[model samples]
Target: MEIADMFSTTTIPFSGITLEQVVLAVIIAVIGLIAVKVIASAFTEMLGRTSRLSALIIELLVRFFSILLYVILVLIVLATLGFDVSSVVLGLSAVIGLILGFGLQDTVTNLASGVWVAAFRPLDKGEYVEVNGISGTVTSVGILATELLKPDNTYITIPNSQVWGSAVINSTRMDTRRLEVKVGVAYDSDLTLAIRVATDLMKNDERVLPSPEPVVVVTELADSSVNLSLRAWTKTADLWGAQWDLNREIVNAFADAGIAIPFPQMDVHLDGTH
Candidate 1:
């Protein structure tokens, strides 16, 4: 007999399912899974090539479609096993409703919030952001959660609802940032000279933008020292470096200009009888 006929005629003990049917079902499952993966990947690649959609949106679309494909695949598998597709779908709907009724409200909220996050796009991948009091580099935005990688290599996962509800501070979203460096000099020091030195330090730095013009102003006169505020605008990427360099340069510049940055001190007097 032909292999096809042999498979058709064979049956497993205690079960009416034929070997051919079982083999076909397994093949269908394997092929369905591969098709799902391939289709999802193709969709992702197509979306990735477009500049109109954000990364977050592309990811959400891919995930949503992949899940849909998996559900269809499950239904197909069940049908292959001789189950009624209509009844199965109805049963699944009832089961889902029951699950939601029990306590999946938070899960539903997360999914809705995920959609809002994709639409609004307050933050994007690769951005340094602080959300819900946790600061990190955004790695991805998912259906249920947003993932981040902290500076110390710690991984963080935050719920979508919290991410959407909280204020998101994206440090690298803007092209430039204003850097403020405050230095306190001795009260008796020449305020004019100190201001000039600090202003020049900011202007000399190549990273600082010249359009706004750097400003150094006497902000406060405290008991121990006079506070000078130095404000300069620089590229966001250069903000930290410029601030550090300006701070070090300010100290040396003040010393060279004969300006003094005093330490806190107090004078005590005792009676002669003591």
Candidate 2:
């Protein structure tokens, strides 16, 4: 038998569909996937340039359209392979409905929660938030899950249902944040001078906002030390930096001013009689 004859006679095992038809279907699928990818990228870039829509909406739209394109591609492939596309779709719909009815309640819940998340705009992409006790920057809000990038660069995917059900703390949503620094000084230290020094430190820092006016107050008088709380407001972006710098500055300032920050200590009493 000639090579061409062998090629022409070969049929997919058990099925009447020929090898040539399978190859064509495979080609169509590959091309469709590539096209879908390209279109999705273009769509994402286009939406990304717009300021009217939030990042969460952009991600949801891109994900939805990509899935839709892939579904259409699958139907096309089935049609090309001589399968009844309409019947396949109807069968798929029935199968999906059955699956949802059985044990896919969580999936449905996640999808519904995703819709609520998008609608309510609780947390958006690029915002740092704590959702359900997990703190991270939101990378994407998808149909079923919300992706986050942690401070340590670790990635987290929380189900949308959990995210929506729990409280979400958005740290970056506000323009300004109040930073509180607590330092304990020796009980003998002058409380008035300590407050003044701490207040001066905050006032000198350029990151600290002048509007609210930083205040230092004696919060507690412990057995070993008097605790001072320095409260200052700064731009949200500058909060961490201002906090770190103020802490270091306060330590040095106390040292320069002869203010002793006391650690836990106990004087041992030895019985002379023993």
Q: Write the per-residue lDDT of candidate 2 for residues 1-274, one digit (tens) a residue.
A: 5766665678778777766677889999999999999999999999888657777777788889999999999999998777899999999999999999999999999999998898789998789999988999998888999999999999999999999999999999999999999999998888788889999999999999998999998889787888889999999999999999898889999999999999988778999997
> Per model, how many backbone clashes are there?
0, 0
Range of the 10 consecutive residues with the lowest summed lDDT in candidate 2? 1-10
Candidate 2 lDDT for residue 143: 98
Question: What ranges in model 1 sit over 4 Å off?
Answer: 2-6, 9-16, 48-51, 269-274
* Model 1 worst lDDT window (10 residues): 12-21
- Candidate 1's TM-score reads 0.91
Which residue runs of candidate 2 sit more than 4 Å off their true CA positions? Answer: 1-10, 45-51, 265-274
lDDT of 1 at 237: 96
lDDT for each candidate structure: 0.92, 0.91
The alpha-carbon root-mean-square deviation between model 1 and the true structure, to one decimal in Å, is 2.1
Clashing pairs in 1: none
* Best model per lDDT: 1
For model 1, what is the error of residue 246's alpha carbon versus the real structure, in angstroms, after optimal superposition? Answer: 1.7
